[model samples]
Target: MEPLAARTIPDLVRAGAVHFRDREAIVDGAVRLTYAQLGEEVNRFAAALAARGVGKGDRVALWAPNSWRWIVAALGIVTAGGVLVPLNTRFKGAEAGYILRRGGARLLLVEDGFLGNRYVESLTAAAETHESGTSDLPDIVTFDQWEEFVGGGAASGGAAGPDVTVTPDDLSDLFFTSGTTGQPKGAMLTHRQSTELYVTWSALAGLVEGDRYLLVNPCFNTFGYKAGVIACLLRGATVVPQAVFDVRETLEVVQRERITVLPGPPTLYTSMLDHPDRTRFDLSSLRVAVTGATTVPVVMIERLRDELKLRTVLTAYGLTESCGTATMCRPDDDPHTVATTCGTALPGVEVRVDGHTGEVLVRGYNVMRGYFEDPRATADAIDADGWLHTGDVGVLDERGYLRITDRLKDMFIVGGFNAYPAEIEQVLARHPAVAEVAVVGTPDERLGEVARAFVVTRGPADPGELTAYCKERLANYKVPREFVFVPELPRNASGKVLKTTLRSR
Candidate 1:
């Protein structure tokens, strides 16, 4: 194994080439890339980008589904000394344009079409519309075009570009927050930060060689991209990428591939648990399951262990600003602890609860370098003492486990009483008919603000009955003032409910 200081992304690929040369690195149905083949592809892509004038400090964006190309592109960009900017594939034209322009991307790689949508055509239209006369518009390249560009220059002796020396502190990836409250800002992650996060998470999760990882979540999200894909690569584990989430198909893949590790949001676990064909698949091979992006309901965790037969069901907590994952429950944690706590901070990281407001603050190599081109916001987020203020209200238990109560901004003052959305959401999630729920503070003439819940129900249920159920457990002021039933809550690509969108509606 390479030393941590010497283990760069490119180094990981090179090591895998020698250790697991012919072993499967990534599998996407009919497509499979051996470690050696993937390493060669990474080198070729890196050379192609360097030939196109992409160098150190340049930003390259990848907007596509979960595929072999995504991994190759990310590794290529990093190896070429360029910063990688992964865009959410579900972003609309406006959102995509904003990210591209904000990041000042020199190049954009995307799929021709996915899920029947012409992403390349749509992105071109968006670019033309947004930057009609701009000189720094990004150069668009299709997947096949990119492959040809690299393959075309094979005999030119340019496939092996000049090796650029980079330090552990050099920026490698810029992940933008999901921006549930405000506009997104890029969180800069150094090579050391990225590598440390993956290494620590893999140790905490007990991931090892030959582990088959089923990756259904969007790789654009750091949780899935770094913790799942990157971690698996470092461990010589087989990565099975899913283009999109389909419960039945996911189950089938798990059985067919003998997938051992499954990491996704709680909503995904719920969907898999509720799938009618779930019992038909042989899921005994699955040993580890991780849930993040939102709080995991205790009932859901119980069902995951009892019914799904996954022995280790862990809950993780982190943000884009944390380089992916900062804290997560270990495999040996009790079920109740796993459900209630986000686990202790990973090794070499320090987590502290604010003395006054109980806001979670983290300081470590995993913390980001700050938001790109947003010094004021960065200053507000990271304190002068170098601790990244997470803005999440939490409490550290006696055992050093951190339990997130709610987002500080999401907590509201109702009739001069504080009401936390997570507390209310947890209570509502326990209701028999509630499938999904999001609580937001809406304007109230009497009180300064009141809680309003958007709920997705599994069956017929009256709002009055739900209110009565909450009143029994929660304080009168903390109970939701109104309930709005919906088919489903608005969620981002990672399956986190967008409370900001719910509030707007």
Candidate 2:
């Protein structure tokens, strides 16, 4: 067995075959690949990429839906010593083009059409209109075409490519955060940083060989790709990929595959909880169910464990700048703690609360190298002392648990009183008629600044009634002065609420 320290992303894939050759590595409907088979595909894809002028330090963009092909492409890109840049599948031409140009992508591999969106058409247009002088006009290839280019017709007897040696210091990926405040900047993650995070998360979650991981989140996001796909490879676990999320279909897949691990955002759990035929599906095999990207409602956590029969429910917190997961609720944590806290920092990571304002600062191997080609932003995020100021205001309880109060930038001062959106959002989520809420500070002459809430209601509830409900529990200044009812909160591709968008209105 290869030493975990010596393991790169490619090494992890090969190690899975040596340890669990017969175990399934990926299952997508009728398509199932064992560890050994998946390793072969990864190697072939590497050779294909190398043959097309992709080599050490080149950036290969993967703009596709979640599938076995996406995994193969990601591993292949890394194996060929190329930096994998996974773009959001939900991106339109303008957004996708910006990412491609920003990353200086040389090659883009995409699906034909996913979820009624013509991905191939969008990529083609983006490639043509890309205006970055530093970036090459990327070559576009459909997933089918790339497969054929590698070895669809000819016998698979091509000479094995030379080993692409990568040190821990080599950049592995460039993941862009879902720019809520400004333009998105790419977070540079080195091989060692990514591997360290994978190891820490695998150990913390108790993942093992033969575990079937059901992944529903978009692969473009660091949380989904690194935490789900990369972590599974490190632990020799199988991945059940979903091209798109459908509550009914997800339940069916879990039953049919005997899935052991399920990790996604809270919205997914809410959808599953609301499914009328949820009981009809045999979800007894589920061992660990994890949720993140937002606070998990206490009711949702309890129902998932008691009614859904999941053995454990965990919650995590992190960002693209922190290599996916920094803190994760322990398996043994009580339901109350999991609902309130984002958990402690993982091993090999250090987190501290700023003395003056209580902003969270993280320093560790899991932290990104920096924002790519943006020294100004990088300086603002990671100081000269090497600490990545996480901009999130949090505190460590006496028990060593970390409770995120709110984002420091998101905190609003209303009439000399502090207003944290997370606090108000948590209170609003408890309302029976409210599905979701986002609060932001808007300009006001009298109070200097006032809290305004945007809400998604479960039923036809009046905004004024909701405002009055808040006034009962919170101080007059803490309560939202204005409430706007919307069908949904504006969110980025990764399911994070876009406070900038809310503030813009």
lDDT, each prediction: 0.79, 0.78
Off by over 4 Å in 2: 3-6, 123-136, 152-159, 178-181, 410-505
Q: TM-score of each candidate?
A: 0.80, 0.79
Candidate 1 C-alpha lDDT tens digits along 1-505: 5423335777777778778788899998898899888888888888788777788889999988898888888988898889999987765544566677778889988876766656666556656665212323588887868668787446534456436765667888888763334356899988877776787788778788889999887788887788877798778889999988888889899999999999876767887888888888899999888876555678888898899788788988887788877788988888889988999988888899987448899998888899999898899889998999887889998888988876766766564334568767877898999998899988764454688999999999899999998865454676898999999888899998788898787
Pairs with steric clashes in candidate 1: none
Best by lDDT: 1
lDDT of 2 by residue, 1-505 (tens): 6525545776677777677788888988788999888888888888788777788999999988899999988988898899999887656665566678888889988886766677666555545655222224588778768658677312333234336786778898998753334355789998887777778787777787779999887788787887788888787788988987888999999999898998876667878888899889998898888776555678888988898787788888787799987888888998899888889888778888877449898888888889889888899999988889887888888776788876656766453333567756766787899998988988774444688999898899887788887764453566888888999888899998999899989
Give the distance in Å from residue 87's predicted Cα in candidate 2 to where it truly belongs: 0.4
Error of 2 at 106 (Å): 0.7
> How does residue 345 of candidate 2 score in lDDT?
84
lDDT of 2 at 121: 66
lDDT of model number 2: 0.78
